[model samples]
Structure formats: C-alpha cells, structure tokens
Target chain A: MRRQITGFSNPTVKHLRSLREKKHRKAAGQFMAEGLRLLTDALACGHVPQVLVMGEQRDPHPLLAKLEAAVERTGGEVIETSEEILSKITGKDNPQGVAGVFAEFDTSLAGIDRSAANIWLVAQALRDPGNLGTMLRTGDAVGAGGLILIDDCADPFSVEAVRASMGAVFTQKVAQASWGEFLPWLRSGAGQLVAASLRDAVPYRGAPYAAPCFVLVGNESRGLPEDYEAACDLRVTMPMKGRADSLNAAVAAAVLAYEVLDKVDS
Target chain B: MRRQITGFSNPTVKHLRSLREKKHRKAAGQFMAEGLRLLTDALACGHVPQVLVMGEQRDPHPLLAKLEAAVERTGGEVIETSEEILSKITGKDNPQGVAGVFAEFDTSLAGIDRSAANIWLVAQALRDPGNLGTMLRTGDAVGAGGLILIDDCADPFSVEAVRASMGAVFTQKVAQASWGEFLPWLRSGAGQLVAASLRDAVPYRGAPYAAPCFVLVGNESRGLPEDYEAACDLRVTMPMKGRADSLNAAVAAAVLAYEVLDKVDS
Candidate 1:
C-alpha cells in the first residue's frame, strides 16, 4: 500500500533519516540505496526494500510503478514525501526522486560455493569508501566470485561506498574477516593468492595466475603489510614509469582484475 | 639567501592565497603546488617556483635547503609563516608543511614534436578534477607523450586535480583546445584517432591501435557526442559484464591506456 507523508516529522521519516549514520544502519541491518537506477538495480537483483520513499514531484513513470509493485509484493510500504523531506532524509541539497531502504546481506566466507567460485578480490584495510565501492563494481565487471574485506576496512554498506558501487553492491557477495581468520579460510580453499606490492615482486604481466585465485590489494596509504605480502602465493608489481610512486588503489584493482580475467579466459 | 615572513598580511602571503581560485591563477599565470612531494616534482621538472612557503613548525631539512637554494638561484623568495597562516592559505585544517607557487606551462598543439610524440590522451568535457588528474597520471604511467583537454574540461592546475595527479601535472605536457580547434589540429597531424565509445564499437582488446594514436575519452555523464564518435578512425568498447552500464572514466582510461601499451610492446 502507498502512503502519503506530508511532514518531515513523521516516524517513518525519522527512521529513514537515522539510516544516514553507520550505527543506525548496523542496528537496523539496512542501508539506503538512493536514486532511481540504484533502486531499480536492487529490485532486479531480488533485493526487495523494507521501505520505498519518493519525492512528491516525481512523475508517474513505469519504473517507479514497477518499484512500487515490487515493494508492495514484498509487504513493504511506499511513502510519497515532499522534496524537503526527501532531501532531509538523504542529506543532500536535492535528493533523487526515489530512495530505497534495503536490508544488508553480508555473507560469510564459508557460505560461498567453492565449486562455482573461481576468483575472489581481497582488500586489506581499504580506507576509502569510494575506492572500496569502485573495486566492488570492477570485481563484478570481471565476474569475480566474491570480495573479502580484511581488518579495519570501510563499511561496504556506507552511502558513499554504495553510491560508488553503481549497484554492484546488490550483486556482489561481500564477506568480512580479520587477517588471521582470512588466512586460514584462504588456505582451506586452496586457491592461488596473488598480492599486488611494490617491493620484491615480479612484473604483473609476467605473473602466472592459476585458476581459483584470490587477487589481494592493499590499503590506500600504507599498502599491504609486509607479513601479508610475504604470505601470498605470488607477489606482482604493476609498472610505474612516472614520478608518482603508486596508482590509485581502485585503478590498480581494475587493471589487475581485467588482466586476471584475460589470463583465465585464455 | 632564504628570507622568512611571519605575518598573514604579507603581500606574498596574499598572492599565494589568491592562487586557490582559477581566475587569480589565470591572472597571475601561476598555480600553487602543495605538499613536499609536489614541490620536489616541480623543481625536478625544471619549473622554478616564484615563491616557496613553509609552515613555522616545519623542521629544517636538507631537501628544504636544496629547494630554498634552487629558488634563490632563480631569484625567488622563501617565506616561513605560522601554521594558522599556512592553513588559511591552503584552505585545509592542517596544510602540508611546504607549498610552491609556480608558473603555469600551457602547451599548444603546434608546439608538440609530431615525430617524437607517440601517444596523446584527449579528454572532452571531463567534469571531475580527480578523474581528469587520474587520467593524467595513468597517461604518464603508460608513457603517453601528452594530455589534451578539449572544451569545458576541469582546470588541470586546480588543487584537487594536481593532488590527484600525484605529480604527473609537473611531468606530463598539458594542452587545452576546443573541439573545433582540436579536430583541425588532429587532422593536420594525420595520426590515428581511436574513440572509446559504447555504440557499434569493436572490443578494445581486439582493436588495432597504431602508433602515434590519439585515444579520445568522453565526458563523465553524457559521454562522447555522436558526431565525434563518427569522426574517429576506429571506435572501441571495454567489455561490461555487470549491471553498471559503464566503468568509471579514470578506470576506463587506465584499462584502455594499458591495453594500448601492451599492444605496442608486443
């Protein structure tokens, strides 16, 4: 059923506003996926929203109707809110016409089907939400089986990270673990682990990446810890011919991911 | 000789602060390159600073001495101000210890040595400063001869762009021209023009990228205009196997740039 919310002080409005913070998102086990395209992508991925919020000025579009039907089918309520309310809920000057509050689906490392999973991207202490999200999108692009976040990484469900993922947040299986926990899980899987490092590594192009591999990227500033780099099955370096010592973490991940895909396909 | 200015109201201090804006940078024909690494890169690129500013808390170091000596040899002054003054000048709560004001070097298409220049990156109406700068860094990493910004692109000298470039702004040749102007210059050069487009394009890996090629990338939102795509000698598309319609502009550029390098080297 569709409900009309005329004021910002409504209880539902207050509930949606609280989701802008990580604590509330965690407590509620939900995150806000804003904009029309993200909501559409979430629905397409079979992620039904807990609540759908739309601006009062939103036109009667087929996509919006489809989203409303999806939410209704899932026993969720759709609320039409004024622009001011929508903006307040989104913490933006002008919020997109639609936003969906969906439940978080964090998977465990043990839950993944090993037979179907070939490649995994493991990011260690990745601090930038945008970089983490872009890696998720890139991992999805290259058809990686899953993403593993290790030790003090940014929240994958954060608004900035979700926005940067461009809907890959819905399709990609995200697993979180500590360095110690991840090492054992990785060893049990028996996949080749390729780490990108600048020190004492073979050229990335020349590295032989066997199947069922996990490509590990390091943090933005400090990079992979020395112990972690040493632990990997193979260490590879992307050539840097310019004055800059390193490439952006997300860019490095994309390049390496595509290269891995090429090698696997060949 | 090294001189120190302690006041926030000093004329040199005011001049350095003005460079934060594009208009002031244009009027003075100079831009501020912040942080120790950027200043070092500028000096290495033979760009003698007009002024060097440092926070009072900065420790005396050999690198500082070398930079001061270089500035003195070029008839430039080195000033030391309080942390408060440096913060105000940089618009950051905690500005880097060192910053340099250097003259802008805008190259023209006619000035480039056609015989020596093998690859050039052409960005049309790129809006984000960070994306533009990342492309510059990637171009530099691939040993691209230069970067060409066409029509309504972000200023390369903007602080965000420069910081994102990670010193590539100092080493890479940057040229700016309108589409009308660039088309004629490109035609006169008689080099291959490969446009990265989504429509009716061959796979990027399979595309034949001849030497002395100009790889054209489009704006973040709208992408390349249809006419521009039609005008290119060849059009290539990066494979997208995910829900996202397109890759981030910088990632796409990096992937394509590396592919071009791989093809050339092989």
Candidate 2:
C-alpha cells in the first residue's frame, strides 16, 4: 500500500522509531535499517522490507525504483515522509534518504545449513556492535556460511551493526545460541571447530585445516575461555609480535577466516 | 608538582578538556588518553604523561602508584580531582579513574626506518578514526613497521583512534604524507606497494610478496583510485563469494598484512 506520513508523531513513525531499541524490536519482531544501498542489497538477497520509509526530498534513482516496486509487489507498506520525520525515525542528525523495517531473520542454531559453505565465523561474548558487524562482512568476503553468536553477543540487528555490515547483513547467515547449544549442533554436523589459542596449537599459516571450518573468537578482552579453547577440534595461533597481546575480535576472525579459506581450498 | 583540583572550572581541567577537540589538540600539541591500563601501557613505553589526573576516590594499585612516581620523577604535573571533573576532562560518563595528557608523537614520513620490519601498512584518504586505529593494531599484530597515512586520514591522536588502537599506537610507528610524497619516498627505499585490487591481480594466497612490503588500502566507501591501483607493484584480490563487494578497510588490511607476513617470512 502507498502512504504518506507528514508528522513525526504519527503512529507509524513512533512504531518505526521504537524498533531502534532492543526491547521494542523484540516486541515488534522487526528491526530498522537505513541507506538506499543497504535496502537495495537486501532486495537482491530476496529479502524485502515489510515497511519502506523514504524522505520526500530523496533524489530519484532507478535502483531505488526497483526496490520500491519489489516492496510494493510483496504487499509491503511504502511511506514517503518529510525528511525531518525520516531523521526522527532513524535517530540521526543527518539521516540517510531511505530506511526500512525488516523482520528479524531466523537466528536459531537449527536453521543454519552447515553444508552451504566451506568456512564459517563464530564469536563468543562479543560486546561491540561494530565488531559483530565487521565479522559478518568478513564472513561474506571469505565465503563463510554465517556468523554464529555465542552467549550474550551484541545484538546483530542493532542499527550500528547493520550499518557496519555494509550489506553483509543480508548476504551472510546469522545464528545465536549458547555454548552448550552450539557445541552439540556442530558435533552432529560435518564441521571442524577451530579457534585462535595460545595453547598447544599449530601455526595458523599452514595448519591442517579441513572443510566446513568454523573460525571462533572470544570476548574482546578476556578472549576464549580455557575450556572452550581446549574443546576446539583444532587450535591455531596467530603471531602476536608486539606489546599488545591479542588482535581485535573481528580482525582476528577475518585473518583466521582467510587462512581457513586458503588452506581448505588447496 | 603534586596538586589538588577540586573545581571543574580549573584552568588545567579546561585545557585537558580542550584536547578532546582536533583544533585544540593541534594547537596544544597534546592529546588526552583515559583508562589506567592505557596510561600504564604508555608509561611502560617510556611515554610519561605530562599531566596525569586521577579520580579522587580511585582504587589504589601498585602500578598506579608507580605511574604517579614516574610522573613526579619526570617533573610532570600530577593532580587528584573529583570524578565529575575527571569525566568532564575525559569526555566519558564513567571515567576510568585515570587520564593523561601526552604530547603527540612525530608522524613525519622521513622518521620511518624502512628496515624496521618485514611488513608496513598504508592508507589513502581513510576517514574513520576507528578504522585508522584498527589498522594500527593490525600492523602491530603482523609486526608491520608502521602505518603510513597517504592522504587525508583520521587523526591518529584522536581519543577514539587511540582508544580503539588498544595501546598499539605507542608500539607501532605512524607517518603521514600526501600521495605525491609517499610514492617517491617508497621508491627511494626497499618497499613493495601491495594493494587489494582486481586489476591484473593475482590470488592473495601464495602471491609473490617481498618484505619491507607495504599493504595499502583506500577509503572506506571508495576502495581506491584507479591511478593508485595502476601504481601498485602488486595488486591482489581476495575471493568474494557472497554478495557484499569488499571487506572493511581495517579487516582487509589485516587479511592482506598477514598474507604478506606469511609470504615474506618464508
């Protein structure tokens, strides 16, 4: 349906603004994403926004026309509102010309298809939305199946994360589960659980990596728990040649993901 | 000298707070850093803060006491102030109880030693402070000699960049120059300018990489100028299996830096 929202206090605008917070997003089962390019990428991935809100001042683009048609064809709501309301809905001083409301994807462990790709990215207790999103982008770059968030990770649906993903949010799968749930799920499937550890491990460069590898990193500061590292089917170590003892969680995941990608392929 | 500043309006507090701004920091040639650990790391690197401010109700630690003595020994100023004032100076809600003012280090292109390490990182028109700091941390991870900012990049001395660097800012060298200046400088020394590109490129895996290798990346949104790519000694492309076009700038640097490190060391 086509509509227009001229007021910032409109019920639709309020509902859209509510999605910016975690509890409201959980209640509505929807999350907000901005930027025309991001919504376009989401369309390319066969995911259409349930509600599309655009600033009336937005410059016309053919790609945006395609996105609007796809949303309208899917029985989605398309609302053109004043730029001020758009900024209010996005909670930004200078908002992107477009924003969309998408229902949260299936993030359950059982939903992940292990056979989809040769590499995967996983994080435990990741607290930063930017880092969480960067890992998703890294997974997309390395052809990883998805990112599995373990135990109290920053919400991947948060606006900060979705923006940082740079459209990877739509391309890569995302799964969330506790350690107990993820460990058993992996064991039941054809996968290799690998982690960067300082334990009895091999160098990350030439480590014997197998297909369907899961690259796991831990909390930003504490790193992987001792038992978690011990449980890995294979543990690899990246060289830390400076005063800082560890790499940033997302950067570490990307480096390890590329190594796994290079190794398993050869 | 030892002193107590209970008032937020104190001139020292005002000056320290100003360091949070780029213009003020440039005028003062000093930057503010918070967190006892970061200050300790700075101290360990023989960089005693010229002005050390502590929260009045701060916990007592041996390391902190050592830091205070070192500041005093170095003839630097040490002040105990209210947490509110500390927060005002650090521009953080929950201040880490300690903050310091350190003079900005030399970021001249001539100061870098080409023979310092096997790998180096370069960026052209990099905008984000977090990405700049992450690149510094990645450089530290791969034992890269330093990070060279080739054009208009984020200020390395900014609070966000320093905090994101996780203390790598002190360990790794930093240099800033225009593209015109950087090209001639690299040519004058033994360094390979490697960038992630698809133009006449080879697979990033096992590509011929040489030390004193400089892995260059461009702005976050715009990958790199075509002319810049044409100038690279080696252009490599990492596989993109998913829909997203590229990796995050810092993540790309980390991935490429590791490859260069692995290849050159052998």
TM-score top scorer = 2
Candidate that would win on DockQ = 2
Q: Supply the DockQ value of model 2.
A: 0.82
- Where is model 2 chain B poorest over a 10-residue stretch in terms of lDDT? B257-266
What's model 2's TM-score? Answer: 0.96
lDDT of 2 at A18: 90
- lDDT for A219 in candidate 2 is 96
Model 2 clash pairs are none
Candidates 1 onward: DockQ, in order:
0.62, 0.82
Candidate 1 C-alpha error for residue B100, in Å:
2.0
For every candidate, C-alpha RMSD to the true structure in Å = 2.5, 1.6
A124-153: candidate 2 lDDT, tens digit per residue: 999999999999988888888889999989
The digit string of per-residue lDDT tens for model 1 on A119-164 reads 7788999998888888888878888876889999999998889988
